[model samples]
Each structure stands twice: as C-alpha cells, then as structure tokens.
Target: MTQLSSNQFIRNLTIQDIDDCIILESKGFPPEQRCSPENCRYRLSVASNICLGLFETTPLGDSKLIGHILATKIATERITEAGMGKRIQGVENSGHFENSRNIGIHSVVIDPEYRGVHLGHIFLTKYIEYIRQLKLADKILIINKESLIPFYSKVGFENLGLTDCRFAGLIDYDMVYNL
Candidate 1:
C-alpha cells in the first residue's frame, strides 16, 4: 500500500468530483454496496456534508481529487413513544430529510492505490468535525451488516440496535454515533 505525503488537504466535494468517487467506490466496495451514478450524484448534491479529494497543488491548472466521503441527512419519525431516541432535539423536516435530527453516513471511499495513507481517517475526521462544528445533528447513523462492524467501530460508531434494513432478505445493523 502506498502512502501519501502529509501535506495533502481535503476540500469540499463538488459535482465534478462524482466520477472519481464512483471509480473509487467501484474498486473499494462490492457491487451490492456500491451506489449507482445517479444516486451518487443526488447524494453528493444534497448532502449536508461532503468531503472529497485529498490533494495538493500541481503545476497544472487544478489540484487532483484523491479520495471521497459523503454524508446525507437521515430522517426518521418517532414511531415509538418508548424508543430510546424518540425525541430528536434539533432536527427539521425540510422535506429533504424526512424527520428528526440525524445525519447518515452514506459512503466513504478512497482511491485503491492510496488506501494505506490514512486518507480514509482523514476524510472521516473532516466530515465528523464539520458536523460537530455546525452542531447540526445530535447523532450520526449508518446501516451496515455484521462484516463491516469492526471497521465502523474503529471510527467511534456503536451498534445501537438492529434495524429492518433488508435488501432481498439480507439484514443490516443500525449503527450510531452520538455527536
């Protein structure tokens, strides 16, 4: 695995960065987990937070986009009065987000050649930090299966409980991180 120099910087993702992100996702994830181009663009366009491209200046006209991470708003209604997270404090139902105060980590992908460079950590730190700064959402959540729990745990997420996130009978964990 190759390592990048320490001077690299992560910048806000833009529409132009979608292709690179798609390529990285295709390489880093299995087909079942990969998002389609339309979905990716919609997500990138609407996310409250997006961190893409760890890069440095070049002699050429622009910097290169090296990595990407995208987080979208997660909206859930308080269906159960006894539920632990029933009352979401600061969330708004802006139509884009369906219900309460939460953000969903949709995707995190790094260029395959740059995996060992800690770019993933750098990208995640930037995303989480931005939300922290804004004080926007009370919690962050993700839906993933058992096999990816270890990786998500390393980044401060915990298994809050199980969710009915089934795709053709496959189940997923409801992971959360309190911000």
Candidate 2:
C-alpha cells in the first residue's frame, strides 16, 4: 500500500464533492448501504460536525476528491437530522457516554482505484482530529462489516458488541473507539 505524504489535503467536504463522494461510496459498498444524496448533503451542511473528503493534486495541478468520512451527532440531534431512518442507536451506544458527546461515523469510502493508498487512514485521522477540536466527542461509534474489523482495530477502534443490523439483508457489527 502507498502511504500519503503529510501534505495531502484532507478537509471538510463541499457541495462540489457530491458526485465524487457518491461515486466513491458506490465503489466501496452496495447501493443499499450507501448514503442517499440528501444525507450526504446534510452532513456537508451540519453545523457542529462534518464530513470530510480526501483530495490529491494531479500532475496538472488540479485536485480530485477520492475518499470521504461521514459523521453526525449521535443523539436527539441525530434524530432531528436524520428524521427516522434505520435509527443507528444500536451501533451508537456511546451516545450516552457522560464525558463524550458521541459522534456517529456513518461511513468511510475510498475510490476503488485508490484502494492501495493510505488515504483511508488519512481521512480518519483528520476526521478524528476535527472531532477532538470541537471537544464535543471523545468517542466515535461505527457500524461496519465484520470483515473490516481488522482495519478499524488498527485505527484504534474496538468491537463494542454485536448488533442486529440489516442492509440488503446482510448483517453487521457495531464498533467503537474512545478517542
């Protein structure tokens, strides 16, 4: 795998990244598990939390977004933003952690063509740092596939427990990280 240099640009996503973000998500996951356009838009517009995108400058000097990390408030605030869909409360157990105002890491996706690069880690590290800056959350909750456990573990996440989840009829596990 190639490592990203410290200078790589990872920042808050903007409206211009919508198509790239959606395309990257589709590359990483099935259609049913991907965030809808409206959800991505909401993440981009949320006040206290944010979604991030990874971009690399091309040889010609233009930059292209190739990865994203999506996060949102974990409690009643999430209820207001999401308006009752799957209600990830099961995966988001940290929502009530006294010292930590939880942030649900709803998705992380990289462009398939960019898979062998460490942009995913870069994206997560930046996202976590951003969350810490707000000091609103010291913990992050993730709902993910069992197969990705090793990857998340390497990034400081642990298996909080199992959850009865369904996505295109497939099951998943709930993972957490106390940042």
Candidate 3:
C-alpha cells in the first residue's frame, strides 16, 4: 500500500494499462532500452498479477497511471538474453512458482514528473513486500546498468558483479535480493 496521496495507490497492471505503460516507457527509457509493445502485451496478458501500477485518482474520479514494474519468474540464477531480451522463452509466465526461487525483474519505470521525489524507492519497497507476502520466490533478481547499481543497492539489492549479458548494447550487472 504505497501512496503519494490519499487518492494515489498501487494495483496490478493489466492489459488495459498497455497504452499508458508504453507512454511511460518512452518517457522513462531510451529508444533502444524500452520494452516492445508485443512483449508488454504478453507480460500483462500472462502475468499481470506479478506486475504493478501506481495510480492517482482525482476528485473527479479519473484515474491516471503514474508508474509501474514488470517482472517474471526465473528457474535459475543464470542471466540470459532470452530472459531479458527475447521475453518469450526466458522467463516463466506463471505469476508464482513452485520450484524456482528467482523472480526476474524485467523493467521498472517511473514517470519523469514523479521522479526526483524518491517515488521509485517507495514503489520498489512496496513491491518487494508484496512479493514476499505472496511467497513468490526465495529471491529476486535484476540486471541493470552501472549507473543504476547504487539506486538498486539503496533498495537492498546486492551487486553480484558484472554479467556477460548485453542489453541494448550496454553491459549489465547482476543483482539479487534474498527473501
């Protein structure tokens, strides 16, 4: 239950949120770094329960998307292009897992207008708690660039050093948070 205001809250992101998410993706990531529309659709269609959206509801009853996180289950600690890039065969489509102890965080995007206020920190904290509550995995994993290492570290993800996988022409480091 993370909130920016009384009217702002978090919920599972669904297919209905694709357009809003795509817009936010563009604002949050470079052209080569953003997730594709097809991938977004598939993730939402198959695992929306594991994805989350932050929204603000106005007095007029209008709801606006503010930010979101995309994730999937992984069977191993091995980071691969299939999991981060290919999208289809890389991660599990199930919202939760029985044997897999890893949850692969695909993307996290906060609206530029909402950044600089530590909203990403708050949102990620809440997401971690939510997943823990669901018993989704024994640990969570993320592949992020060097510039983002400190940010993810602040949220408790331990850096596992540089990985061989390349995303959008940029090398990423492996990070983990044990449940």
Best by TM-score: 3
Pairs of residues at least 3 apart in sequence or in different chains that clash in candidate 1: none
Model 3 over residues 119-152: C-alpha lDDT tens digits? 8998999999999999977888989999999999
Candidate lDDT values, in order: 0.64, 0.67, 0.82
lDDT of 1 by residue, 1-179 (tens): 13346556777777777887788778877887776686677766766254445665566646666666665565552111112122245544322353447776656677677677566765676667777887767887777778878877887888866666553245777788788
Model 2 lDDT per residue over 1-179, tens place = 34566445777787767778777778888888887876676666662236777887888888888788876656632222232133355564332223336667777888888776676776687677777787777567777788988888888888865645453555677787776
Please report the candidate that would top lDDT against the real structure. Answer: 3
> Which residues of candidate 2, in runs, are more than 4 Å off?
1-3, 76-100
How many clashing residue pairs, candidate 1?
0
**lDDT pick, better of 1 and 3:** 3
* Deviation from native of the Cα of residue 35 in model 2, angstroms: 1.2
**Candidate 3 regions with alpha-carbon error over 4 angstroms:** 1-3, 85-99
Task: List all candidate RMSDs to the true structure.
Answer: 6.4, 5.0, 3.1
When summed lDDT is taken over every stretch of 10 residues in candidate 1, the lowest stretch is 78-87
Lowest lDDT 10-residue stretch of candidate 3: 89-98
